[model samples]
Target: MKKWLIFSILIMFGIFNLNEPVLAEAGAADLTSEAAVLMDTQSGAILFGKNEEVKMYPASLTKIATAIYAIEKGNLDDQVIVSKKVFDIDGTRVYLNPGEQVTLKKLIQGMLINSGNDAAMAIAIHLDGTMEKYSQHVNEFLESEIGVKATHFVNPHGLFDEDHYTTAKDLGIILNYAMKNEDFREIFGTKQMKWDGESWDTTLLSHHRMLKGEIPYPGVTGGKTGFVDQSKQTLATTAENGPLKLTAILLKSEYKKKIYDDTIKLFDYGFSNFKSSQVKKGEVFTSGKRQFTYSADTFLTDPIDEGNRTVDSNGVLNIENREGKVIQTVELKPIIKKKLEVKNTAQKAEQSGVLSLNSIVGGILLLFAVGVLVLNRKQKRNRRYRSR
Candidate 1:
């Protein structure tokens, strides 16, 4: 009896342990980079962040903004004349001659695929006529169009200007915005392209190792790499697995391998712990007496377990992680109560009208019956009198 009781207790304890929810493994503490961020592209949720808001040099990542801006603002087919100024710019170059004429589209391709500073200078000059003007216009465009607040660029090529700095969170925002444009996506994902420039003729290759398959990470869609003495090494990577799309930004890493490792870690954490949840169009959520709904279908990321959703009285939906930190917030439109009230009022009026009509009909029938009965009685009396 004693042995059986002990065995039963052990079995019950094992069952309880199995039923308990497992917490997600935290990855931020394991990263070696100075600043990093992981964002869900579908819902714009930050899954993991470490020093993400600290301003640091972006290095060559500035080309990403320049490329997207040019794609949206400049015509692809327009012939852009290379100036002598581009030849003097230091760093990577497509080696353009003084008067070499190239299409705006090709220059953008060279700048992004090969990280060519010369190509970036040419695009900047062609679009806004001078580097200073280009900087001013691009800054305005970033703030007004892309909605970035913490990023500022002094030049097109992120060569090393103290004034040109952006945080990891801001870079993540910029990359997410750029990935929305189809043309930018195509160029950004290109591993290698044939370059038929005026001076330099070679196959331009992407510097991002994972994107080029050198690191061999699954679901890597696009990437951008940057490096300078001050900025160290910075990387932007985008990946997708089923419904979950992720963007990772790593800044100020000392070595190339470490940044890539950090990126893989970030991706693994995101894919393993989080899931994409869809809120359908017109899906209604209630908070006390107020009802709110989304006008269009929306996707959001949440933890696999222990996640909570709460709506405030103002109809703001807050998605919280297991720790109760709000990872994302969305403003939901209030469902108008007046329409329902009007519908109920109309129903009540129709019912009242029906009742009134029934009462009137019943009264008329009763009066008719009374009149007939009286007439019948009078006739009977008259007949009796005649008989007598």
Candidate 2:
């Protein structure tokens, strides 16, 4: 009997353990780039990073910011005359002649799809009148609109400039922000478009290998490529698999193939290990006596394996990996029901007090009226006795 009982307890323990989630072993990413980051497009969570915050040259990746900025701030339908400065600008060109009239939208397409330095210069000059003002306005737009801190651009084109620099993380943020805009998304993902320039009238093909089907990634939606002597082989790529959308940024790889390879590794790790989880707007979470909920639906990036969520006293929801490291934190709005209940209770108490005071005043007035009637009757009786 004793042995049987011991066996039964062991079996119960095993069943309990089996019911709990089994955490998969964490994956590793080996990359060749000097700085890289893989971010969740929906939740803005960083899944992998190698010196992501370190300052590095962005090369033509600068155009990602430039393209999005122009699309939002400039009128795409407006006709922009190509300026003389566009012809002399260095690096890749769509080969526009001086005084060539092109729509602002066409210039943006040429700049993004073909890495046209001339197109970029034309757009910059057309929108802001000069490169100097364009740089200042674009910088302000990036900081105020997109919330990038460690980036600055002296020129719209990513030509070699000592003052122009951005980081892998910042590039990821910019790409993520840009992808939300419809016009920017359509232009950024174009693999090929017809070019009708004064000097160059042919097809403009994307320089990104994966985007152009040269590398053949499965879910590659958009890409931007950049390189210069100072900033070697920079690349930005966005991909989607089912419900997961990811952005990968790589900077300072010696070889183009190596940067592409690094991007593949980052994507593989992200898609395999992480999954998206949703928090509905009205769903409530409790922390002791407090309850928290979101006003709008939001998504969270969670490990495919075991993870935990904890709500703190301040209504902050912390999502942690299996190792107890916090991967994401969301500030939840406190549910105001409890506060309303307390206020209602206080109001009732105040009303009760007011009613009690009213009752006391009524009783006093009743007794004073009765006393006045009795005194008037006594005075009338005394006057009747005197008359008798």
Candidate 3:
């Protein structure tokens, strides 16, 4: 009996573990390039890519980090001086001539929108006393936030330096992280923006096909474009449609147009390949308080065995996942009935099993006690009859 009890307890443990919800692995991507990636903004699902981890010169793509750092350490309205060193920066200048006055905010717009190498230097000079210190700041950020093992930097502008290099995968990750910030999303998405009495726009409007209505994607929401004769035409582009947000990063395309073609193709694949399904809502779900919902076809991997799920009309849906283990319960202060209805509706189209373990133990205990009583009675009757 003791051995049987031990075995039963072990089986109970197995049942408990079996009821846990298992998570699925991330989805993979398909793209043709030296490196590339696509992901659902909210889901963190990797939709597609090729050679994503290969390290290469990021060129002006380096400005994404520069832009992010400036946003954090420098205020938008803060005044910044354009050092003589910063004003003379070659390649993609926001046209910052020597002694030119500009606000930190407008400089950021210049840096991001124009891919200004000089803006990077000016912002760096102001924040850390020098661009070198600012680069150190970016390096520390890379280690803490990006978890990039192979990335290093020598400049904020992403000009090719032997010491400056990053993996395509890491750049994609940084882009995603940056896009979530409202400041970044707002800055990178604009086709044309002016700051501090300085005008900035996407370089050479002829380069952007979206401006010409060439790509069918909703429109370019925001992103940086990159190139080094050696790095080829490296492009990072993001687009928004109705409910979806997508980003693509490509390195070293053969033709300039290839950058545009590849970006649009990746976006098309994401928007076309999967339907935007709402998996969860962050809100408490009051009045409209459903945090999570499943479609009619949504079947719980394990179904509830008993109790059609009871709510005291408080709108709390109490559901048991087959093992009498509750999987989901929501209580909304304003309406508990609505919570119950949602719980019931979620389980409606699904067939589930009944809860299996409660009464068995109770029945066993009762039977054992009864047998002990009967045996004692028999022994007492035998003793009494013998005495008589």
Candidate 4:
């Protein structure tokens, strides 16, 4: 009777609280896309990912790279004579007629805003001379400049090619790089633009639903959408709320709405769970007698837990979560003091070698100066002897 009375009292106190169960963080994202990635654009940290590294068709997202490449490499004012080859390309187009002329800037705007295949081909052939050469140059540029690994391009227009493929993470990498350019960012985020082409003179409208307001989402900064029979529906979006800037990439989604839904959930997860944080430039961290300072101001978006963060002897700051997975790794500069300097003597040996080289060069220079002085003195004595 006492035990039963105690149980009843515990229930009344709401000790169980089964109706208001707390959801776990890992399972919070309910995504249906085959592959997706959400990243903090400022920090390059992955906020949420599902098969992010898995290789898949990027479709028109390839133009994000092409647009930036052209903006940086081509003279925007130069008139490109429309070639017959542009009309030969497949998929969406701005309907450029052969022998018609258009500015590089206008073609870029049309290509990005309207998903114009002909514009892409025109830019490629005009800038790089050939479609085959354009692919090689762009692939190399993406790998060398943007640091993308799991992507390859066969055509600038992103026509279905078996060899052309990229991952969600790679697309995020390309978008992050492209967004840094003011020119590319302006066109990338543009929803509508007037086109006075010789063949098709109409306003080019963005196909991205969120960017166009077809799908209402707050803080929609820029977006790109693509679909092909082999690639399915692929989307890329960028948004900023307060100090947080996020980029979400969805690939191979069977349902178009699923991509948008997954994007919203990803953004919500990032904004709700993560926050902007910084380890100020020159903030000292002590390990034993040695001290290390962050070389530059680094911004972070992961959940802050100072205790879970560690600095190694090499001056790398590693932040880990409760599950022990590494969330971010930042490079730091080692601040050597009189007492703490000896701890990293082995690492400083390279610097010492450089000093030694400088010392050797200085000694040789001094010897050369002394030789010059001695020669001058000898010459003076010879002249004096001749005078006597």
Give me the candidate number with maximum TM-score.
1
Between the candidate structures 2 and 3, which one is better when assessed by TM-score? 2
Ranking of models by TM-score:
1, 2, 4, 3
lDDT of 3 by residue, 1-388 (tens): 9998987898877854654332211222323356777665543345565767788888888888888777876788887877889756778777675566778877777777777788888888878887677778889987787566778887888887778888777887788778868898777766665344444433423224553356545756766778887787777877766666666788877676766777877776666543333433333332334233222222111121232343435556454433444433444333224335776765653423222334677788999999999999999999999999
Better of 1 and 2 by lDDT: 1
Worst 10 residues of 3 by lDDT: 295-304
**Candidate 3, which segments miss by more than 4 Å at Cα?**
1-32, 195-208, 211-216, 276-388
- Which candidate leads in lDDT? 1
**C-alpha lDDT of all candidate models, in order:** 0.90, 0.88, 0.66, 0.85
Better of 1 and 3 by lDDT: 1
Each model's total of backbone clashes: 0, 0, 18, 0
Name the runs in model 1 displaced over 4 angstroms.
Answer: 1-25, 287-289, 339-388
Q: What TM-score goes with each of the models?
A: 0.83, 0.81, 0.61, 0.79
**On a 0 to 1 TM-score scale, where does candidate 1 land against the true structure?**
0.83
The lDDT, on a scale of 0 to 1, for candidate 1 is 0.90
Better of 2 and 4 by lDDT: 2
In model 2, the runs with Cα more than 4 Å from the true position are 1-29, 339-388
Q: Which digits, one per residue and each the tens of the lDDT, describe model 2 over residues 129-179?
A: 988899999999999999999999999988987788888888888999999
Query: lDDT per residue, candidate 1, 255-296, as tens digits?
Result: 999999999999988888789978999999887787899978
TM-score of 4: 0.79
